[model samples]
Target: MKDVSGLLERTAQSQGAQPRCPLTGTLMTRGLTVPMDWRRPVTSRERQIWWNADHSFGQIHPRPALDEIPEFYDFPTYYTHDDPNSLDSAEEERRIGALGRLLGSIAYRFERGAEPTVEWWGSVIPRGARNGLEIGCGNGDRMKTFGAHVEATVGIEPDQRAAAVAREKGLEVHAGTAEDLPPAIRARKYDAIVFSHVLEHTMDPILALQNARDLLTDTGILSVEVPNNASTGSRWMGERWRWLDTPRHLNFFTPDSLRACAQSAGLTVRAVLFRGYVRQFMPDWILDEARITAAQQRRAVTQADIDRQVRHSARLLAATAMAAPEKKYDSVRLICTR
Candidate 1:
């Protein structure tokens, strides 16, 4: 509701080493310094995290240059960047592991929410819509899963390798970030835009939302999901939180901060929803992330070790299973309109 034009003018400061809070227009202070990357153990550069005290908004300190950003996602092990179709049954089993392959159905049912990942966006997509767009569509799995609800869907990805993989499946995927829309995509307004897990990675999330507004039809829907800094898992795990996913994630948001961000982008905030599994509900999830960090402290965990972890996870079911997560959930979803 307040004037954000002056705020936008100041975002030029982002070009410097420090970044201003996109929602409040305040310069952020230091939060903590991340030493090792759990997922990418080879990474040794220690990066600092900065945050705004009042609002739960944060950014990676000593900002990475735009050119250097692409290299961060170049690794082959990043799951989201992997090509799903390329995984043969053997490879899939290897990735999921022996215990997972054995108890696959049971574990999946017990852990997966009633709603599929695509349902989060599909449930809100306007009925009778003809076209939609997804930023950071990954391997196009989300699009293929939810495309039936809409006539057609396209995607934009910053990773050229991941974008090419999606394109191979006869999808309309353009390789680029939302901050810079290719001329081919900038030409048309989309009926709906799904910006899941992509905003925080952008150099400027507020600017990205504003650009999405320009691409959206007046009646279009924009659904966004980001890691919730206030989530219980985030608190329990601290720097070890799986979602923290530093280096790859350039920004962090809490419930209030996310709402203000949408409103700040000259858009109307329709609803705010918090949803995701926590360690209380999924004990194995923590062990899974712990293994990544633990591998560094000692030898790599073997299949036998994973099997023991799976058994331990099953034992934790009764004591851990109480109620679903509410405010303590892992993600914050914002439904908005132009």
Candidate 2:
């Protein structure tokens, strides 16, 4: 683990030339750059710059690399959101639900892996939606919910704990990395490949999405949801960006970069929507930022903390209504057809 972390540090030091925009194939630059800080007030200048700019506003180019392709092969050590002792089981459940809702706030009609609602997808899926694959079906709950709708549904989960949870939910899950997709999943191609917040964690987005395309039947749609690097939440939090889970999250994406990745992978993006909204907990993020900077303040992500996050998020909802909408505040969704 130390070696992996060391390698990651070295990778972070190596910055490549600025990336090119997929839309115009031109170089992209940040219009508004905010230095890393906790209490810095969110600026209107930053928001407008993000809105009108062709490229993302504050994304740190050339993300750090990992020792292995499956970035999560070794879970991250930072304890921002994973604390067993912080709260009792009941409180933990509440936090998980809150986080889920925070994530759910995003406007995605098709619950990434939850496929039992074929009628939901059937309505959108032009008739003859044959086969589909879900790369990281966490807990399989979503797959179990929506698996029945798809002609065939298969899930890949590298974590043993998550895989067990998925199996318990009556899902056909494989405990392995997408880099080593099960033979069965690879053999069968589908009309669509769904990746929900899974691509950002991969070491190589191009290879991962290309693998997805290989498994798709011609003209298949690749549905993905990733943290918007261009989002206000991201700019508010730089290196300590909650979504930029060092070592765990190896790749970051914005509407532009995502399009770049998809085009490089030979896929055409049909639509990109940034509707997910979460006002976010300012104090908690401040605390987390302090912890990251000062080792003494660092602690595991606990249930009690999550509880507060839920309550804070609720307040944020009302606040968003009263104030400007952080349209680029939450995770973004992209629907692409190969």
Candidate 3:
């Protein structure tokens, strides 16, 4: 591990002094040097990830100052800016293949108990919530999902371009970080506030949580979901894990760290749930790995590709069920009340 330690020391010197954990002020360690992922290369900024001593949390060292973060969000390819309305419905349906949709519909009947990503998110908003806010609500997707339950849905997006798209959808979006809220948002109390994978992007998650708590009414729900740093994915893949999309993802949280961070923000942790291993996550890994293994990889979808995908995905399903159950999955979701 001498090489690793030397790398961390060199990284520290280049970045100018080590960075402490944003939430706890603990010294960070386990410096992992990684290249930007093939899919989400937000910036060319060289970064090293450092985990807190307890291994419960990790973050990019030399964390970009709040204002400097915009440079990393190279807008066009950045997914948060995807305006749903701009998508052509014909092309969208084509993307979701006809045969796949037919099979999925049939399977969906048998899998009625399965929670859709949107429904799972909507479940956390307190019953009778009149107004709800989604921090970092990109294109207002989840906001639209929860709008049925709540009378009104609002969003806070740091990227002005993304916020403009959400606003075009008639969503009341504030283009600012939760750590520093606009007066309009600070003036009102919400019945529910959702982070939904947004907290990790903030400069100070604890401060963001506190601000969210303060924005809540007497009875409110605060829902948060972040990549589980201690998940089977992270444990198995280490620095190679897909979720460690650093520079974009500043904070890495495990279940315990998330709970502690939430409590530190002065919110009551009602329940914590771990989900999204086999269903939401593993398929991509399975398909990608399978593609690399097969000699006859094809650019165009074919019956052979379908058969291969199904076979590989089934094996992973069985493996995940046996090996990484519940709390060991990819995401950590929490429901908090105030």
- The segments of candidate 3 whose C-alpha lies over 4 angstroms from its true place after superposition are 1-16, 37-43, 83-123, 279-318, 323-328
lDDT of each: 0.69, 0.53, 0.66
Q: Could you tally the backbone clashes for each prediction? A: 0, 8, 0
Clash pairs detected, candidate 1: none
Please provide, for model 1 over 1-338, each residue's C-alpha lDDT reduced to its tens digit, 9 standing for 90 to 100.
Answer: 12234433444466566666666777888786666666566764666788897877788866676677777877776776663443355654565465555443443444433233566556777878888899888877778876877888889988888777788889999876777777777777878888878888877777778878888888888888888887655664566567877788888888877777788888799877765643333434534555644554545756565556556445444332343433345787888999
Off by over 4 Å in 2: 1-85, 88-120, 279-327
lDDT of 3 by residue, 1-338 (tens): 00122333433443546666655666777567665433333335456888775637777777665557777665475667773433355553344355433433333333322232657656666778888888999878778876777888888888887788788888899877777777778778898888888888876777788889988888888888888887655665555565666677888888888998899889999987775554422333433333333322223344465456555444434445445333346777788987
Q: Give the range of the ten consecutive residues with the poorest summed lDDT in model 2.
A: 43-52
Models 1 onward score TM values of 0.78, 0.62, 0.75
Q: Candidate 2 at 143: error in angstroms?
A: 1.8
lDDT of 2 by residue, 81-104 (tens): 132444454543444574535443
Best by TM-score: 1
Off by over 4 Å in 1: 1-19, 83-122, 278-284, 295-326
Q: After superposition, how far is residue 279 of candidate 1 from its true place, in Å?
A: 8.3
How would the candidate models be sorted by lDDT, starting from the highest?
A: 1, 3, 2
Instruction: Give RMSD (Å) of candidate 1 vs. truth.
Output: 5.0
